[model samples]
Structures are given as C-alpha cells and as structure tokens.
Target: MAVDSYDFWLFDLDGTLVDAEWSYTRDVFDRVGDRLGRPFSDREAEVLWHGLGGARDDQLREWNIPPTEFWPVFHAEEDPQLRAEATYLHDDAAELIRSLHARDRPVGLVTHCQAFLTGPVLEHLDIRDWFDTVVCCTEELGWKPDPAPVRHAIRELGVEGEGTGVLAGDGANDVGAAWNAGLDSIHVERHDPAFRGQCVLGDYRITTFRDLGQ
Candidate 1:
C-alpha cells in the first residue's frame, strides 16, 4: 500500500528524517574514543553512528568493546546544540511530514534518540509541531524492536484500534518494532544495504518518500 493508505504514521528521527553532519558525527566519536583510550576508525564511527550494522550492543561486542562502557561515554560526548546545528532534514521527509500534518493526520515520532538531543534537533529544524506525539525511547520505556516505545507512541496518538497505522524508519530495529506492535512498516533505506550486511524487510521499502507513491 501507498503511504497515504495508512491511517496514522510513526517515524524515526536520526537517519530516518533528520541526520547530523559528518563532521559532527566524527567529532563525537573522536571524543568518545579519547575517553575510552581507543580510537575509532572512520568506518566504525559511521556504522555506530547510524546503527548501520544492526543491534548496537551486539556490534560493540563484536569489536571487543563493552557496551556498558561505550554507551555512557558516547552519549556524554554529544553536544546537543552543536549536533542540532549540524543536523539537516531530508527533503522528501520534510514533504511527507508536512503533508501529513497539514491534513491533520495523527502523526507520531518514536525514536531511539534521547530527549535531550531529540528536542534540540526538532527545534533547530523547526518541525517540532509536526508530530501529534513524540516518544523518545528510554531504558524504562524500552527501545525499538521491543515494541514498548512504539506502543507508547500509539497510545499517546490515541489512534489505538482506530484504524491502520505504520512506522517508517531506516533501521532493521525499526521494522522489528513495527511488526512486534502489530503495525505495518516502511523501511526507508538511507544507505546501502550491503553496508548493513543485510536487507531490512518491511511491509514496504523505498529509498525516498517519492518511491512510496504517496
């Protein structure tokens, strides 16, 4: 089905709708590396930054890095303002979200990006009001692929049992969350699936919103 076929819509933020500049991503990783006493190669930075390799913890473990040790430093090194300044919204994402909001459709955001960072990016992009509800995944609420956060956003949108809903994102975990929550999904591939080492399946898959046949 087309994007317009969904009664309600959910979105992922970083890499899906908005993304930070490469320089910003590089800087964050550089600082994280310094703190950990180990430097990350450009490829490692890219993979971790975009979650291109799938489960972040699993990826870290493969690199012999302890996730428990890596995450805190990683998050600590991110400067919200600088990251926001470096962030840009995808043009097709802009078109789709604005169109949905303009139509008063129930649109929500369910992202792994924490509240501190998510707030600044949305504000910087001036698109905060577009979503009827925004759900930032937390340790307590659980992360994507678990269905808790997606279900939380669905509850907040008050669209439960109203009609069909769908979540669109750029990661496998996003698709997993959608299916786990009993919602349709769209995988917007922002990078080469080869880089991720697997093709992320969804109810629909496209590289851009235009490909959704909206």
Candidate 2:
C-alpha cells in the first residue's frame, strides 16, 4: 500500500499512538479506593483499567461514587500525574506522523477521548502542528463505533474519491467506524487475535505503523 496516495489519514489517540501506561482512572481508582477504605488489588485494577475504556465518568459510576465528591480530590493530586505521564508518545508514533507529513498527506486525529485529555498529549509531544484536523468527543459529536464522528472528520478534511482516506485505530469500534464511513481501515494491534474472529472485517491489520508500507 502506498501511503502517499491517501489524501487524508485519521488516527486514534489512546492505545494507538500513546500507550496507556499512566492512566488517570488507575490513579483515581487507587487513590479513591485507599481513601474510601477499599483499595483495589493488582488484578482488580487491571480489569477496571481496561473496562474504563477511555471514559472517566463510567469508571466513577462503576465505583458508585459521585464525580462531585471524588473528582476534586483526584483533580488536585492525580490529574497532574496523568498529564505528566501522557507526555510519552509511542516510539514509532512521531516517526510515522513525520513520514506521512513528508509525503504531503494531510493527517487528522479522531479520538473518543475528550479534548482536555487529548490536548495535553498533543502539546507535550509538540506534534499538534502535524495534524490538519482533530475531531474529538464534543456535545455535538458522539463516540466512535458511531460513524457520525468519523464522517464529520472526513467531511471536515474535504477528502474525496474512493479509498483516498484511511482510518487507523486499535479497536473493533474503530474498524466499524471506518467501514460505516466507506473508508479503508488499518487496524494497529499490540498483540494478534484480540480481534481474531473479526479479522476479516478490517482492510489491513498491523502490529506497527511501519507495516503500512508492506
């Protein structure tokens, strides 16, 4: 596949570009758990972290805690750490972005994460300039697996022609969004078989951005 042929490339933020090593939910969960006298175990934290799935509010609900009560404490202590840790981007992410830019291919970012979370990572990496557009979860635009956000991004970037755009992401929702929008999709996975039964759905499945060339 010649990446240069694509007029626009859309990317997913969490797990695709940045590894979620220092998740805010994990920090808040642990802190809140300790404070509430219900500390989470390593196993429990792992499950809760994955279940959070980029939505902070969902995690709070799972714990049966009110955001008004919990978030202030979390904001004071854990939010800063989350911001600091998000500073690290994936090893190949910057290189991939640079390569696409060098090819004169316009890059856009589509993330389920809110602007508050996405903004700092883009700023910290100093690669915000590389993206031509960023479509995040706002009041008007809903989450991924819903084609509306993806379509909005494609329309916003003004990319036309069949297969002229690609949506690159790591989850099933990402694949579904691309297919729904009538665009080619490249699935970037950390390990194989996470979407094994559904492998036939994606146009391409790769472990790294480097594989896009092949």
Candidate 3:
C-alpha cells in the first residue's frame, strides 16, 4: 500500500512542528494588560487568550478591552518576547521535513500565528529552509477550522490536483482545515499526552511524522 497520497505537504506551525505551546498565552496577555494600564490576573488573561484565536469582538466586549488598542499593545510589548520563548521544536519534526526535501517534495507552512512571531520562530528553529512557502495568516485570511488558511496554502503552493496534498498537524483545526480544503489530514498527536484515541476528523493518525509510510 502507498504510504501517503501526497506530493505536497501543508503543515501547522505551533503544536505540530515547533512546540510553541500556542494554547498558553497568559503571561503575554498579562504583560499586554500591564502596558495598557490595566493589570490582568491569570483569570483575565485566560479570557483574553480565548479571544486571540477565537471571537475577537466578543472578547473585546466582555473584557472591555478595546480592539483597536489590544493587538498593537500586545504586539509591541509582548509578542517578540513570547516568540523567543516558543522556539522549541519536536524531536522528529526536522527529520520528516528533511526526508520530504530529499525526495524534492514541496512543503508549505500554514500557520494561524502572526507573521512577525512565526517568522522569527521558524528562523530560530533553523528548519525554515525546508518549506517552499509560508503563510502566516491572521484574521484577514481567516484561521484554521475555518478553511480559509488551508485554501490559501493550497493556492500558494500551486501543486497540481486535489489528492496531491495532505496537511499534518496535532490539532482538530488541522484536520478540519484539510477536510475543508478537500484534502486529507494526518494527525500527529504524540506531543499531546492528554490525547488518548484516534481522531475521526483526521484521515490518519500517527505518533510522529516518521510513521508516514513510503
């Protein structure tokens, strides 16, 4: 049997590649609040973070944090420092990227992370050269589980045909993104110790990218 049905690979940055611990942003949020003259407790920071990848408007309204000021404050004071902190990568990730590169396969990075943040993280990890393209999409292009960024990666990679691509990552958003883009998904949930079963949303599930068969 064929190991994988793809010549083009779309990857998610945070959990799937480097362990950005994307879900944790309390420290940064706290800093943002401090800079704005409002101190955020851990509780308030958690509420703001859910807004980061989720409903911005609702978060703004509920927290009374102004949308116009929140991001700028966050980016200027918190993002760079957090980017440095999130630079660690999984052990087998680079091996998989290299294996694909050896075969001359095309790879694209589709991340919901900000360009400034993602750019430095990729550079710091030294694996940025492996990907053919990188789309650091934010609210403008839509986030994962919404399908917009997946489609954006697909279009930018310019790979021929539908089945030629597969997106591999650690979260449901990756699987959902692939499904939304009419491609397959491989869930690499090894790093997620809390995860204990197969993902129906994922076309395939593996402990690591090395398990992707030839």
Candidate 4:
C-alpha cells in the first residue's frame, strides 16, 4: 500500500520523529550512573538511550543491573525542560507530518516517553497540534509491542479497525505493536541494523520518511 492510502496513521515519538541531543542523553546516563554507583561507558549509554540492543530490561539484566532499581532513578534524572530543549525533529518526519496535517488526516502519537517529557517536547517544538491524538504508554494502557497503547490511540481517533491503518517507528517494538493490532508497520531505520544487532522487519522499511516519497 502507498503511504497516503492508510485511513489513519500512528507514530512513535522519541526516535522516529524526534530525538534528544547526545549531550543530554549522556548527561542523563551520567546522573543515573552516579545515583546507582555504577558508571556507564559512552557505548553503553548510547545503546540504552536509543534502545539499540533491543529491550531495555533485557539489556539491563545483561549488565547486571536490576531494572526495578534502574528505571526509577533514570526517570527521576531526566529533567523535562532540559530534555525538551535538547530535542530536535527529523526534517523528513516534519515534512510528512505537516503534509498529513494539511490534508486533515488522522494522526496519532504513541510513545514510550512519559507524559511529562512528551508534553514539554511537543510544546517546545510547537508541533503538539500535528497529532490528533497522543497516547503516552503507561502501565495501565500497556506499552508498545503489546498493542494496548496503539489500540487505545485508534479508539481515541474513532477509526474503524477494518480501515487500513499504519504505524511507523524506529524500533522493533513499534512493528510488533502494529502487527499485533492488525495494522501495517513501517520500520524507520534511524540506526544501522548491525549496531542494533538485528533488523526489525516491517510491512515497509526505509531509512527516512523521504523513502516513502513524503
């Protein structure tokens, strides 16, 4: 199917459309490590920040860090305003989103980013209105790859399940969630497959939104 053929669209925020500066990412990890009394090398920080190694909990386990102990400190160390200032949108993503918004298409955001940070980033970027619905993954709604959050966004958009819908993201979890919800998936490969240690298959794979002829 063509990109414009979808009845509605859903996207992942952090890596797919926008990303934080490396300095900010590094600082966050530094603080996390300080709090945990465990120092993370630059490579380890990069992998965890971009989820390059796949599931974060699994990576944490491999590093011998208790996920239960790591997450709270990680979230606590992330300052919303600082993060928002450091975030930037991909040009291709911006063009595609603006085009979709101009056409009055239904677009939603489903992200692992918490509500507090998501709000600030959207506001700072002045693109909050681009999305008709924003679904921040939570314990209650469930995370991506589980389909609950994507389904929740679909419900919020008031779109029918039978209509062709597509979800795009830069992670395996996004593709999994789309497939689980019976939607086509777009894998936006923001990082090299070799660096990720695996290729995330999707209905469509591209390096950028331009590959879809946005």
lDDT of each: 0.91, 0.70, 0.71, 0.91
TM-score of 1: 0.97
Q: By summed lDDT, which 10 consecutive residues of candidate 4 come out lowest?
A: 1-10
Which prediction has more favorable TM-score, 1 or 2?
1
Compose the digit string of candidate 4's lDDT tens values, residues 48-71: 887777778899999999999999
| Model 1 misplaced regions, further than 4 Å | none
Which pairs of residues clash in candidate 2, taking residues 3 or more apart in a chain or in different chains? none
Model 4, residue 46: distance off in Å is 1.6
Predictions: Cα RMSD each: 0.9, 4.4, 4.4, 1.1
Those runs of model 3 whose alpha carbons end farther than 4 Å from true positions after fitting are 1-4, 21-26, 33-73, 160-163, 190-200
Cα lDDT tens digits, model 3, 53-147, are 23444557677878778777877764655565666888777877777787777899998678877877777777778788898767788877778
Instruction: Report clash pairs, candidate 4.
Output: none
Candidate 2's displacement at residue 76, Å, is 9.4
By TM-score, the candidates rank as 1, 4, 2, 3
| Candidate 2 ranges beyond 4 A from true positions | 22-25, 32-81, 160-163, 191-201
lDDT at 100, model 3: 79
